[model samples]
Target: MSIWWSLHLRREAASVPLARRLLLGTMESAGVDPDISYDLSVALSEACANAVEHGGDGALDGAAEAYRVTAYLDGETCRIEVADSGPGFGAAGGDAGRLSAEAENGRGLYLIQELADHVHFGTEPGLGGAVVSFDKILKWRKGASPLLAV
Candidate 1:
């Protein structure tokens, strides 16, 4: 069950579902349990949504025009990352501000923290942007792929 893919997509709201759909398709084909797949997909969407919102709005024609997403599934675990081209953490809507306002509204970052088993919130090295990464131990359906059974 070694599978991985990456995408460079424009910083747009629609890119969120496009990325999620791809992940879902991959998981479905791999015979992953639907519940687990849904959890990961939700986390992935939050990460991407954050990127689109805080990944900077300038430079539409330049390298900053898009964000990056990468997912890797190996053995019994799956890891995913979403990186933006804007300012990194602490500056993303201000960490303190977001935390304080958490009770009043839904924060994508917070939702991601709740969904994924292992999560990392950090800056993209040298790129000067936020990178949200997470991993979860995978479970398979009753008749999962032979590769995953081992």
Candidate 2:
């Protein structure tokens, strides 16, 4: 089948719920299983929240920076992309996967990588801004099985 679904909106934490609903609903309507749906929602929420909190002003104003979220589903594989119109981080260092039990933050990248089958962070096309994408592998079932699965 095809593999593309997208939604773009201005940066605001309040809009995160909207993005989550849209992304999760798209996967559900595309026939993704329930378990995959839950994972998608959780991962997307984290990505969108990071974008709103770090990329934009987290305001309701229309002039605020923009956040674009795109989701692609093909067979049992789902890919999600979250991009923002803001400056890119120079160098992503530090232990993203710290074992500390008292850390307040710095786990966004770690969680994304841990949960997703595949995760990537980079500058958007044409260097527009930052783009974070992750891929989810759904459980195979019935007639949805492909010749060779992931």
Candidate 3:
């Protein structure tokens, strides 16, 4: 069974938990293992927080200001993508894993990389925004089929 969902949310701090809760609920409903679900939820929170903080301009000047979060589950693997309309990280994003421990910021991408099985940084599909995408190999609870037959 394969499932996918997407959210377009305002670039506000409150929107971060909303995305996380939705992801958590979806994973739970699909019978994903508790550990895997927790890890993915935390990783999703970091990704969403990044999008909220740096994804786009928060001005209310009639511009379509928002960020996007997308998740896909197929069999034993799940992939997630978070995107924003800001100027993007440019060259800095390439060094995401090299942040120092004492740094007050710049740890979001590193956390995502640590939690997800695979991570990618790029532009949003069709929207030309900064995108951080990752995937994990899921382990479902007992009695859960790897693929849900639609």
Tens digit of lDDT per residue, candidate 1, span 5-123? 99999888999999999999988888888999999999999889888887984765665768999999888998999988787775443462354234654377778878889888888
Q: After superposition, how far is residue 139 of candidate 1 from its true place, in Å?
A: 0.3
lDDT of 3 at 46: 91
lDDT of each: 0.83, 0.70, 0.81
Q: Largest TM-score belongs to which candidate? A: 1
Candidate 1: stretches off by over 4 Å: 91-106
For model 2, give the 10-residue run with minimal summed lDDT: 93-102
14, model 2: CA deviation in Å? 2.0
**Residue 145 accuracy (lDDT) in model 1:** 66
Could you tell me the TM-score of candidate 1? 0.87
Per-residue lDDT, model 3, residue 12, is: 86
Specify the highest-lDDT model's number: 1
Error of 2 at 89 (Å): 2.9
Task: Please give each candidate's TM-score.
Answer: 0.87, 0.76, 0.85
TM-score-based ranking, best first? 1, 3, 2
The per-prediction tally of clashing pairs is 0, 0, 2
Tens digit per residue, CA lDDT, model 2, 36-142:
77887888888888788767543465434778888877766788998876554434623442523356874776677767998777766675456788998876434
